[model samples]
Structures are given as C-alpha cells and as structure tokens.
Target: MIKIKIISSKETYSVRQPVLRAGKPIESCLFDGDDLETTKHFGLYFDENLVGVVSVFENKSNNFHDEYQMQIRGMAVLEEYQKKGLGNFLINQTEEYAKFQNASLLWFNARETAVAFYEKLNYTIIGSAFEIQNIGIHYVMYKHL
Candidate 1:
C-alpha cells in the first residue's frame, strides 16, 4: 500500500537530491521558503519506505492575479517508482491541500520534459519556456483551483 503524509522540508531532501538535483550540489536541494510555516512538504511511502516527494509554498507569482496562490517546487519520485502513477497521486494530494488554504490557483516551473504530464492534469502553460541557471528549459504552468 502507498501512504501520503505531511513531512518536514528536511525529510524531502533525501529524495530531492537523487531525483531532482542529481550531480548538482547538495545546496540545490534547499529551496527558498522551504521552512516557512506556510510551506508544506509531502512524502509518499510505498509499504514502509518513502519513495516520492513534493513541496508546496504559499507563494504567488506577479504574473498571476489570483487572490491566493501556491507554487509547487521539487516534485519527484524515485526513478524505480516512475511510470507507476505515483506523481499524479502526489500532485493531486498537494492540490487538495492547497484548496484547504483557500488558494485560488496553483503554479509551478515545470521542466520541458514534464510538460505533457502537467497538461494531462489540466495545467496550462503561461508563456514560453525559459532557462533556470543550472536547470534546463522550464515553462510556467498553472491550474485554477
């Protein structure tokens, strides 16, 4: 069985390092607002071991005029767990959590390769893809709550 639970930011670093920041500095796993009271990190456990993770911040982008917004950052599942629909479950859980906070919209900088995955979840790309320093191309995607 798989379980989703609210985990600390530090707990997410373990998965983030290998999946999202592989070959990069460990500092790359640390994100702004990660420790904020409004921020939340979630972990998905398969059986008794954590296998996937995602972090959400109560941050609003100037590009969006929503009264309340949240941004998703560092969402990833272990390579061994890919193609098992775990990502969809993790994202959907985060969306429900955002709604409880009265969020009007949810946005994130999605990697180019992950665009289709977000699209399948009904998230639309805002503008053209842009580069994020060390990271590759990314597009701003959002979904209305």
Candidate 2:
C-alpha cells in the first residue's frame, strides 16, 4: 500500500535530489523556506520506502489577490513510480493542507513539461514561460482554493 504523510524538510531531500536535481548536487535540492515554521513537506511511501516528495511554503504572489497563498516547490516522484496516480494523490493532499492553513490559493513555478499536468488539475498558467538558469523553461501556475 502507498501512504502519504508529512515529513521533515531533510527527509524530502532524498527523493528531491534524485528526481528533481538529477545531475545537480544534493544540496541543490534544498529550497529556500524549506525549514520555515510554516513550511510543510510531504512524502509518498510505498510500503516503507519513500517514493515521492513535495514541499509547500507560505508565499504570496502579486499576481494573486488572495489574502493567504501557498507555493509548491521541489515536487518530484521517482521515475519508476510516475503515472501511477501518485502525483495526483500528492497534489490532492497538498491542496487539503493549503485549505487547512486558510490559504485561498496555491501556486508554483511549474516546469514547462509539467504544465499539462497542472492544467488537468484545474490550475491556470499565468504570464509567459521563462528559464531558470540550469532548469528548463517554467511557467507560474496556480489554483484557487
């Protein structure tokens, strides 16, 4: 069985490094605000091994008028576990957490390749695509709670 639960920012680095950073150093997986008191990290465990990870931060975007907003960062699932509904499950849990925190919306700089995935979840793209150094193109995507 697969279980999704809250985990420490440090714990998320394992999956984040391998799946998101890939060729980059493990330290690159450490995102800003990851250890903040209001930040939350989630891990997807299959049996006893973590296979996916995601982190959310209490961040506000000028593009959004919501009083409370959350940003999702460093979301990644193991390659072998991709397309098995795990991504959807993680996202659903994150949305619930956001709502619990009184956040009216959730946003993220989603990679260009993942745009369709977020769109399928009812998130709309904002502004044009842009590059982030070594990372490929990305677009700001958001969903209102």
Candidate 3:
C-alpha cells in the first residue's frame, strides 16, 4: 500500500535521490537559500521507499495577492512509480500544506508536458508559456483551494 506523509529528516535522502535522478535539478528550485529554512515539503512513500515528493513555499512577493497564494515546486514521481496515483497523493499533500498556511490559492511553474496533469487536478493556466533556463516551456498554473 502507498502512504503519504510529511517529509522528515530521515526520509529526505529517499526523496532527494529520486528527484535528482529525474534530471530536473530539483535542488535549485527547492533550496533557494532562505526558503530552505522556511518552506514546508512533503513526500509519498510506498512501503518505506519514497516514490514521490512536492515542496511548498510562500510566494516571495510583496504584492497584495502573495499572502493568498503558495508556490509549489520540485514535484516528481519516480519512473517506475508513475501512473500509480502517487502524483495525486503528493499534490493533495501540497494543497493541504498550503491550506494550513492559510493560503487560498496554489500556483506552480508547471512544465508544458505536465500542464495536462495539473489541469486534471483543477489547476488552470493563467498566461502564455514561458521558458526557464535549461527548463523547457512552462506555464503558470493556479488552483483555488
């Protein structure tokens, strides 16, 4: 059976290794110096092996809506673990974490290929596609919680 849980110190290694192996350089998006000290992250495990993970961060903007929106980053599911609902589990955990932080909306820079996946979860694209260095086309997707 699959289980979802908050990321703990002991479980960090399991999650990080898979993310790095996914070839996405999750660390750059995850750490962000200050955020490493403040943001919350979660992972999904299948019988003690971490198979998926997601990270939540407060929007680093002074804009009025910043308080109401939380940014999701570094979401990944291992190759062998895809299409098994683990992504849904991690997304659910991220949303719950955002709600706990009193955020009303969840947002992310989702890769073009993953846009449909987020859309299925009720996330709507807000604007045109943009590119991040080394990262392919992406769109800003948001979901109201």
Which number leads on lDDT?
1
**Lowest lDDT 10-residue stretch of candidate 1:** 19-28
* Pairs with steric clashes in candidate 3: none
Tens digits of lDDT, candidate 3, 1-145: 7887777433444565564334555454344632455577677889878888777777743322655778887788877888877899889888877888789888888899898899899999887899987667888888878
> Clashes per prediction?
0, 0, 0
Full candidate order by lDDT, most accurate first = 1, 2, 3
TM-score of model 2 relative to the true fold?
0.97
Global fold similarity of model 3 (TM-score): 0.81
lDDT of 2: 0.92
Please identify model 2 stretches exceeding 4 Å from their true place: none
How far out, in Å, is residue 114 in model 1?
A: 0.6
Question: How do the residues 16-134 of candidate 1 rate in per-residue lDDT, one tens digit apiece?
Answer: 99988999888889999999998999999999788999999989898899989999999999999988999999999999999998999999999998999999999999989899988
When summed lDDT is taken over every stretch of 10 residues in candidate 3, the lowest stretch is 26-35
RMSD score of candidate 3 (Å): 3.1
How big is the positional error of residue 94 in model 1, measured in Å on the Cα after superposition?
A: 0.6
- Model 2 lDDT tens row, 1-145: 9999899999998898888788998889888898999999999999899999989999999988989999999889999998888999899999999999899999999999899888999999999999999988999999999
